[model samples]
Target chain A: MATKSVKTAQRYAMVIDAKKCINCKACVVACKAENQVPLGVFRNWIDEETSGEYPHLRMSFDPEQCHHCADPSCVRVCPTGASWQREDGIVLVNEDDCIGCKYCIIACPYDARYHNPETHTVGKCTFCSHRVDRGELPACVETCPSKVRVFGDLNDPKSQLHQLLATRRYEVKNPQTGNGPQLYYLL
Target chain B: MREPVWEFLIVNYLFLGGLSAGLYFASALATWIQEDGRSAYPRIARWGALLAPWPVSLGSALLVLDLGKPMRFWKIFFHFRWRSPMSIGSWLLVAFTFLSLAYLWSWLEQDERQSLQARIPGKIRKRIPARVQRWLDLDASLWRRNLAMLGFPIAVGVGIYTGVLLGAVQARPFWNTNLVAQMFLFSALSSGTAALVVARLMDREPVELKEMRFLYSMDITLIVLELFIVLPYLIHGELSSLAVKEALAQVLGGPFTIVFWLFFMGIGLLLPLAIELYEFKPVILGKGTFHIQPRWALTAGGLVLFGGYMLRYIFVFAGQATGFR
Candidate 1:
């Protein structure tokens, strides 16, 4: 009998374009509405990085999500089988099963997970699985005025995300973590 | 200025875990090495063997309380995942609890026998109830030792696992280091010995001052070792990576600097080290009678234990100060 979690066959991934991002935060609002995310907690958001002196400041927005890494740190630290990677490669948490020890939250280097005080469980970006299953874009992607967020299967070469990756250069969050993070940011 | 997810419960839990593990190991070792000798160590061993299980049990209880969904805490036991550090840690806690309880029970029964033997008149000793005689005949301390034989590694496992819990998180660059386990294990040993010293002094038992001094010296060495392992996270973090360097800077010169350096490094490490050093010295200036006032020993032990708790808080908070952007 296999004692481990079932494995995934598909690897869902995300890519963002910093250059095209306008910092409108529509995606953040859309994610909150789609997930009914509790106040003070988030499933997805935009992080702004600012560099250069005050007189010559340059700021850029990078939309962040769960990353759904090939090797997820949160999945490895969850005490119960509360957190798991689906066969389609979307990393998710089972709120009912979660003991809410916060180990997964601490394990997530991206700080993507947050404890939902209302449910007394940890919550994170689910990649709008409900919408994706219905052959629709995620709420965040659908609502984005700039359409900076791209989500799809890396294995499907014809997908928009795959096509974008093939044509553009990008960087994943914390490459040194060696978790094979799937969130890629295009310059 | 976000608050850390972990709070006093975790800090308190880790310290209690270390204390119980250290106490159990020290007692088991003393029992193994003990001969027909007049020493205060036997008293230390007795106290340890008797008191080892409670703190660990209490700490585990505190952990359960700290959980977001305390009711689903049982889910940790129903499913097992080798890939999960928490899965392994929960199992270790269960194992440690069982073994430590057994060790405690053995000693309790031994105390019963000693009391029974002392109360019975020699002429009536043989006439004692057969079941009572049978109970008294069993060697409880020896039974505890056999339990210890299995419990020692498990105890050490619990101690190191606490550190590994944080260290294994690769996303938290400040915590993702091999050094945490070394510092934690050494602190466990030192704090455990200090607890023993405090217990012995408080009891006012007949003991060699030399043994007390030796424990202080040992604690000072462990303190120095812990400092060497921990201070580098602040010193060398800037050279690691931009993300990691920022996280380190938050603790070194950022808002957390005061608590990190003042409370943790200052009061926690250096203060305890200074106290232990003074205790390590001879009663007189150079070579004189060894002395340790119970009050002084208690103060040093309390400071070391406090320092141990501070280390955990720093790890949890500083690790979260910065994240991938």
Candidate 2:
């Protein structure tokens, strides 16, 4: 009889080299299209900042989405256990279970969650969880023109995400929260 | 881009929840008070018990209706996450409601019980034997006393939980303070007392002015305590982080300045406080008899209730508007 192998759980995360971002907003549009996110609302977006003055000015674009924190404030404040996380590190909203109290939205420091008018439930970036389960990249990761986002299993040493994180110096959006955000913005 | 998800419904719910908790405390205190030979505190206690259940029940209905999925509200009860203030709050509201109703039941005078029994259909009443009915009539006054003592802490918890709900969300620095809980507790007590005073003032039957004076005295003390908490809360915000300072600016000298200072502090608190003080100074100094006109009582009580409401409104709206960047 052939020996059976047990598969280890995945720790999915995103590493973004925002220095290459062209501010094209392709990821934002693609995320909406993939998620069927309602117009006037977004699951992800690009934040733009300008620094210096006159001839010495520089513009930077940071693609922003749910940080998928290990200690999610949203999950902590959710009364109905509707906002939860998978063991694989993907945070999600169970629309059926959500009472739409919106306390999760209030709890999140990043302002990552939004109230979905169509479903009358809270919504946020899911790391394209459905696609990730099928061995595909998230919509934002796949559609970025300049390859801004790298998505992979951090648990697997051989995975691009884990290798990049180990090799590169990166920073999280709000480290002060100590929420253990998974998204690493490469320096 | 985080809009205020909670609006008027939430504001009303907070105010009403605090009011209910305060009313229960008022009743419990009255129930336990040592009545002098001719003390009129029982009427105050009666008013408190009679009025406590309705606001919380109505407020709870509004709370459910405010939910995106009103029907799924029952799910909150099934999974009680102790860390979540919302979860704890749902359980608190449920516990408070049942206890308040039972407390009200216990407070029913013998004649009131007879009248309630008379309302029961004759067929149903006949089906229940006299012995069973007599056995059911265990000492309600004793039960009231026990329930009062038991429910006191829960009522205080409910009052504190209202503020803690917002305070737990550190994303909003304006509400992230121990002072919020303290201020809310004092305001709830004052509002609850004011509500009872209003009820008595508007009662069809005349209640003793002496009993009304007791409520006014309680309200005056509560208002002073509330002011102490509110002033420190503002100062604490100013002395904290940049985000907290900016959040407090909303009420201090920003958009909410006029409303906070003029309406909430001036008319709602100080004016009422001054009126009540004037009314009670004679008694406090042991120089003359306690006296207060009905119109003045109505005005003072109404303002206290209004101030309590505005406090919740400012905190909610201002907190939502300012969050960590």
Candidate 3:
């Protein structure tokens, strides 16, 4: 029942440039490679939205991942604490303890979680916890061609993500969900 | 928005929970009123109590099998997070099954006291250890009392928890209503009572009509209750999101129209109600054998059970037909 909030750690966050993303799906490919994500399941994905019929057609490619919300529903709904949070704000799934009940999958409002067919457990973007612990960037950030992705410690004032969040006009997805999503999109 | 994470097994599990819960509750009620010495309906109490625990244990087994890592399902017991309904349900189900078994054993053993124990030789009965007699005495003393104290709430919990399991999902708006728990409980009771009636009819040796005014009227009331909770939950459903509206439409007149209207509403709910209503106050014919028909009563009970299952099936499947998009 105790929380890990007592630890002094950097909270990681991501900011993506929607205008720069070409829907190339390079981030998706990189994520799968790094995580060994199964087919028909995704830790992160791109959602394409368009409106208007003819001349005024507007379109955007929205690259989405787990928000690692301040109040994560997946963590709360997980019966065995399989879905949990680190002090640094990254949400992680402990595959060993997961019962594959899909409670977390239903709880996630953003559809960020996926049931891993191979592991027989629910999984989501871990914010590349392995690489983060090794002082390396996530595979999506490392592999992005146009430098459209920025991932860093939000608590570190010097990090690009911190400066971008302060300087640029950005918005989080599904603000109405009230999870306080950490991932931001630069408008 | 995607393939449903819960499938038919989950539906079956829900049905079993409701059915078992209803039977236990009905058995308890039958025992409570049997003091008035109603011979026609005492069989319901006896068979219902005897049959309650098996389906519950079987349903729990299905739930474990549904979890792909069936071995890992043990984690649910070791890890009990209060916020998670599934976590609480794991333990609740175990408690329910154990207590229901005790209840069944105690009630069935009472019948043995007269028949089996009386046949035991006085010398042998005397030679039996005091400890053995005490254990046998528990059915009448401890378990029968425990059935009243613990059995009722545990049964209700099993009935409502199925609804809570799905209703807890905030992403699935169609099932997220507070009314879901009430609706499921009512359906469980209606179906459960029908199961009791069917079981009672099965034991009857006489082909002639029997006086079961209590069972028929009780079933009719329960059928009315099923409609009472279900109608508003279906009709004035709150459209919290566009996805919910799409999901609710499936039940109204969409992809699941025939199942919802024809099978569930018409045959399951309405027809059962109508048949039972006719049998509740049938017109007396020549010899009066044509008047109070046991077959009509049997049909009504069976139909109510069918409706109960269809209700669970539609709620789970249609709830997913439109999901978070």
Candidate 4:
């Protein structure tokens, strides 16, 4: 059984250039419209990190979303396999199968998923799988004016994301959970 | 500290339903054990069994109704996943409902006298079986008795499932402990028993005072134990200290405090205990039997039932809100 391996590796990931990000909130609006996310809720968020005294304070915005962790707690705790990790490493919800229990919303460390009041089902980003399938980037990436977000296959050594991650220092959110999130931020 | 209207409504329904079902089942068990005239006890048990499913089913339905796409509720079963507590709880509720229905059917078709006759055997069966062939069948009664006997475990199992569902979520520190399931189980039993007492009181029937006293005492003891288990966890700073402290504050002093202290502890526990104490005194005085004014018992029972529902609502919603923060 070990020798009959038929592996199909498609590790999808995103590299965000934090220094270039201006915290404009464009990506947030675009994501909401594309996914039809409910009002007063978000699939992605921009967390602000502040330092120093008020007059001279410096602030950094870290946009957050489902990290699409390799070891997903949401997937592990889901009683009905409605939340799943795609082969490409994108964590997505099968709305049709979801019981709307909100267990996944609780399990997620990033607070990425939301119970859509309209659908009565859990909703979140799918890495714009439909766009990706059509040879286009995610709505957030396409709409970002500063080109802060870069999307590509992590396995391809020549890919811009792979090259950036290889040569630059980066960070993943909530490293303590050891979820090995696919999204990275370049400091 | 302030809960949304939706949260309040949903949690209230969940707690009330669980308590109602639990009380109904416990009452049926009490009646069965007493073996009072079938008309005396079974009538009570039958009403309880019939009433039990409505609240739980309605509560669960309300939960679905509150969801984003209520129509897609069926998808939970279509693509069942063992990793989600909601899925497991849903399936368990379905099974419990079916089992309860069978139990109810048996009770409705039961021939109380024939069931007594069955205990005697042969000659009685022949005479009664021939004479009452049209209106009375002994076989159905046997099946109902057997099914109802089986339902006791299933009933408890269903009650425990609610707790296990919440307890299994390790990520939510407030809900991750084993005590949650135990707490849920105890609450279910307390609520279920209280419901039975109230129903009997309402019907103006002989309120199985002795049995009610025993159940009430047991409920008080379990609530005390549940409080003990909950205290250390609430005070400890090891697991998500901020969240735990916030939750404790919410229940003890925040908006939820009134419901937790005034309703759950006071009415659900204290009131029931006070009445039971009076009832137990008569029994201890060598009377062997006591008469509790049905109206008084009914009032106390109603308060206890309401308190039980409040307890669940406060815990579930408070736990969720704090964990999220």
Candidate 5:
């Protein structure tokens, strides 16, 4: 049962080629529009790393959202089971079930979720399951001019995402939290 | 300026009031059980029963008042969704209010003079219906007992829900943690105890020294736990940790420090602990009950209540201000 479950698990992941990212924030805008995210709260965000004080300053931007972890901390602490890791490894919120208690918000080490002021409930990225179900890429990935975000099923051996992940070394955000985020950043 | 702020404030007030009411009810229960002769347990219990519902109702009202569309508040009940904390809290508040009202009515109707007169068999020439009298007596007592029994957990549950609500948000580093709800629960207990103590002192009722001592010890323990839970997160070098540290520093050293140290720690915990400890020593040594002046108890209670409010305000504002920067 365990082997079959593992074998059949449709793990979806995103590989971001940081070198190719131009920091245009197209992904952020696209995600906001697609999700109808409220003002002052975001499902996606950019983290900037800076180096040098003066003469030679350089900057790098890392766009982040829910990493849809294999062992999601948000799921673990949720008292109502509103936040759950789907069979396909997608960390999703059943908005209808969510109590707007915001436990998952605090448990998330990455600060990926937000409480919608209008709805009085929690909201976050769901890896664009709606689009994925319709046989399309996530809005952010589709809108990205640089094609920096590579999304696909990790379980499929023939998938480009699977082949790339197998070949390249990548890092997940806040690995210490033990969430095992599916989103990987190429060094 | 923002709608979320109003929502946050409403939630804050509800939690605070619920906590205060819970502590009051608990102390009242202690009075009911202990039945000490000199102690003002009955009065306190009566007051607590009467007082518990108003704050929550008012807080709920405040929530509606702050709503952009006030009339829509009823929609929460009609369109109840288990997924919404507001929805759950709303229904809980309604149930709690009804329970509280029943409890209050029972307490108010138990007129000692009337009961004493009735106890005298054939004292009243006018015949009273046995069934009506029995029903009145039994129903009142039953409701009072039931409400008192159920009140404790419900109050605590509602109070703790506030912290859980905020803590559940993974997006805000300051508000996130399982400890958040526990912290909120402690705050509620502390605040509720303080409010009742203050009210009791105001009424010149012989305050429960033992109860005060217990509350003081609990308050100090909770504050210490809160500090312990926050210390590691603040000092950790991660980005979120650093942000939390910055916010903590602002609280510890900035404008909020006076309230945090002077009111919350010094007056709220330290002064009360010192006095209670002094009393404990004498009491334990068979030197008679430590007589705490009503004035001192009231002062301490007021400070503790202030401290509780400050704690919540500091945490909520600081958490929001520090996140993302």
Candidate 6:
């Protein structure tokens, strides 16, 4: 949709193809190792959904994390303004201002946020902004065994993410939330 | 099987916040009525004013304690965001507490000749300097009226904010209805009135029969009103999308069904409502003389308080039990 006449910041997005996922959970482990997420809580996870019965059964391993929506419910519900969004649409929590009331945990439709017992603040997936800032991929995107995840700027017409959106049929989780979530699941 | 972000502390805070709002509203009503030359319910104004602050103070403390970083609770006060219910609620609570305290002070500052002065210790009364005593004894009728008028909407806001705090969470379908706020407001009013009735009847002072009857009738109306709003709240949830329907099933026929039907609906609401209707029926029908029986009044009032708490408990836990999944 871009004419390339106006400059805009990179709008980061993720597209996952669950059909290729083997559910080895390497991405989950890598996310934890990179983010140091507290034990018993996760910044990213793999959920398994099975369908049919008997010999016709099929299962899908869906890896999930914060969508970092265009309009995030967690940001709207935060009382202290600790939860905020970047110009590039990456939602992050400022630990210094978070009182840890946990309202955002309840507000998240995807159950993405967790109370990090170690840091005593709400923690969630940030798309590994630290790595992205350094011209590197997120730990999860880099670690997936089957190449299940594609991460790039949706605003860049030349990027693989933009190309996928232009050519593929995909669905987003909980579209009813009206948060305009950026995570796309290729159908 | 995700953990709930809130627990018992939040339930208590919701209940107490609503109760304090209801109490303050009821007291403001009493203050306005007393201005009409009715002398029976002066004690209601005093009792409600005095008791309103305690529950809210304790509730706010519990809310802060429930936080992950309790010491950083003060950060909520640095700025206010109108779009955030928690931010609005925090400011509402602080404003209500101060108004409640000021409202209490107005009652206490009434002319020293009143019976309230007799309760003060003789030594403490004597120790006060003449100038301070004169100032303390000034007739604060105007201040009382103005404060009551100003505080009425604030109290209502506090009552509604408790429900809106949960209702604002779109992710939790169980609490995503506007009816929750309306139901909570009426429930708060009923519980506040019940509290005043219980305190007045249990005290050593002689209960004003007229005031007692007024409170009974009011509670009955409020209880019935609460029932109307609560049913709609349930029906609205059940009739929404599948996620909302499933979330509401937690109370409809799910694990919370027992407490929802038995404690809150039966004992908490219907039973107390039946008692008040029975007690007030005689007075309304004009068939025979009736007296305010302390025993029955206490029973009804206590049940209402219990029911109010149960409403918050069920909604809090059940709402958290389900989400967009």
Best by TM-score: 6
lDDT of 5 by residue, B1-325 (tens): 1122423555457455655456545554644464444334566666677677777777667666655345545655665546545556667777777777667666766575367546767856247678756755554644555567777777777777667666655545566655677767766776676677677666655656665655555555555665565455445523445545555665567666776677666766567655545644555577776676766666666766666676677666655544433
Clashes in model 1: which pairs?
A8-A87, A109-B171
Write the residue-wise lDDT of candidate 3 on B158-251 in tens digits. Answer: 8889888888877677888788988888888778888877877787454334425556667778778778877777666744466566668887
Per-residue accuracy of model 1 over A7-104 as CA lDDT, tens digit each: 43556788887788898888889899888999998888777889999899999878877888888889888888789988777889998898889988
Docking class of 2: medium
Tens-digit lDDT string for candidate 2 (B202-246): 988786866876787788889989889988887777888788888
User: What's the distance in Å from true for residue B179, model 3?
Assistant: 0.7
Q: Please provide, for model 4 over B164-201, each residue's C-alpha lDDT reduced to its tens digit, 9 standing for 90 to 100.
A: 76667544555666677777776777677667766666
Interface RMSD of every candidate? Answer: 1.4, 1.0, 1.4, 3.7, 7.5, 0.8
Candidate topping DockQ? 6
- TM-score-superior candidate, 1 or 2: 2
Compared with the true structure, the alpha-carbon lDDT of candidate 3 equals: 0.81
Candidate 1 lDDT tens digits, B1-325: 3458887898888888888887787666555554564323566667777778888899999999999988888899999988887799889988988888777766665567678578888888878889977866677665655776787798888888888877788777777767877778777766777787777776766666766755676677778888888877556766787877877876778877888788878887788788777766664357665666767778888887777777777776777666654
lDDT, each prediction = 0.79, 0.88, 0.81, 0.70, 0.67, 0.90
**DockQ score of the complex predicted as candidate 1:** 0.65
Residue B241 error for model 4, in Å?
4.4
Candidate 1 regions with alpha-carbon error over 4 angstroms: A1-9, A50-57, B37-40, B109-139, B210-214, B231-239, B282-286
In candidate 6, the residue pairs with backbone N, CA or C atoms under 3 Å apart (3 or more residues apart, or in different chains) clash, namely: none
In model 3, which regions exceed 4 Å deviation?
A1-9, A54-56, B34-41, B110-146, B205-211, B238-243, B282-291
Listed per candidate, the RMSD to the true structure in angstroms reads: 6.0, 2.6, 5.2, 6.8, 7.4, 3.7
Ranking by lDDT: 6, 2, 3, 1, 4, 5
Ranking by DockQ: 6, 2, 1, 3, 4, 5
